[model samples]
Target: MRGLNDKVTLITGAAGGIGRSLVRRFLEEGARVVALDLDAAGLADLETQCAGHAGLLRTMPLDITDHAAVQKTVQAVHAEFGRVDVLVNNAGWDVAKPFVETTPELWDKLIAINLKGPLSLQHAVVPLMLAGEGGKIVNIASDAGRVGSSGESVYAACKGGIIAFSKTLAREAARGNVRVNVVCPGPTDTALLRSFTGDGEFGQKIYDGLKRAIPLKRLGQPEDIPGAVAFLASDDADFITGQVISVSGGLTMHG
Candidate 1:
């Protein structure tokens, strides 16, 4: 959490479960945050929730899949803040279904949101970081990408691509002092997870099964994520790059 005070931080998917938590954490650490999300109403709600830190937060509606828009937004942020200190690529979307049952349309949406969107943001922001003071990039992937999830084949593929991309980008950008890393969450209790498990006995069965399978015997909470994310984004992780940390409560582990 060190060296985050007054930092210019941008977070996508800022209206969602984990996204909101990330926003609050950064504000608490005294960072200036530009919260971006497609859900304008949700962003408003988040703003109200953090009204005490009004000057520290600004919410913007954004569709990360739009490349040109992403570039413009990054430019706007740099114009206003002078520099981007941290960029968190956290926006993602998915619907759980078997691979064969899923359609190309769903695949397109998955790739656009989970993969291309983050890539677009990085493409825009990295140059700014390289030109100015260096920055940190913390990408939110998934345990499904690291291991596998039964109903998320395409989503997992996109996340896996993110993992690979972050490592390569880290290596490429290290000399410039622009650090890149990944945080993969597992079975988190988010709206996305609830959508993944629709209402029914089947949903309950999947939920219970996951709880049982996880060594911690519970699903992950949004709050459980920011500590690791903020750490990586902060100067404390100055030496750590090209690494993937699983914040899955023992659901996934790597040596």
Candidate 2:
């Protein structure tokens, strides 16, 4: 949480469950936030929610999957905010279904949101970070990436790609003092998770099974994530890079 005051932070997926939580947390930490999301209405509501925060909030309507659009936004953000201090790649989408049962169209959407969007953002932001002399990039991947998840083969692949990409980028960006790392969430109760689990008995069964499987006897909450994310984005994590931290309530662990 240290050294975050007045920092220029950009977060994608700014309207969703975890994304909104991250925005609120960063603002509370006194960071100037550039909240980006495709949901303009949600961004407006988020701005209202951020009324009394010490830091400033600027919302932008953006589709992360659009490469040229991402570049333009990054440039515009830099022009307005002066420089970006941190970038949180949190926008992602997917549906739960067996790989064979899933269609290529779904695969395209999965790759575009989960993989390509972050890739494009990184491509645009890293240079600005290099020019600014330093920055932090905290990618929100998934435990599915670390330890595969059923009904999420393509999504897991995209997340796994993110894990690999972050480490490589961290190593390459170290000379510029630009740190990169990943946070992999477990079975969090979010809108996306609701979509993953169908209604009634099916959803309950999956949710209960996850609780029983996890070392902790409950599903993860959206609020449980931002602390780790903020830590990674703050100066407290100056020495930590190329690492993947799992926020999965002990459901996933690495030595």
Per-residue lDDT of model 2, residues 1-255, tens digit only: 899999999999999999999999999899999999999999989988888862489999999999999999999999987899999999999888999999989999999999999999999999999998699999999999998999999999999999999999999999999999999999999999988777999888987898898898899999999999999999999999999999999998774
lDDT (Cα, tens digit) per residue for candidate 1, span 36-73: 99999999999999999999998889999999999999
Kindly report which residue stretches of model 1 are placed more than 4 angstroms away from their true locations once superposed.
none
Candidate 2, lDDT over the whole model: 0.94
Those runs of model 2 whose alpha carbons end farther than 4 Å from true positions after fitting are none
lDDT of 1: 0.96
RMSD in angstroms, candidate 2?
1.0
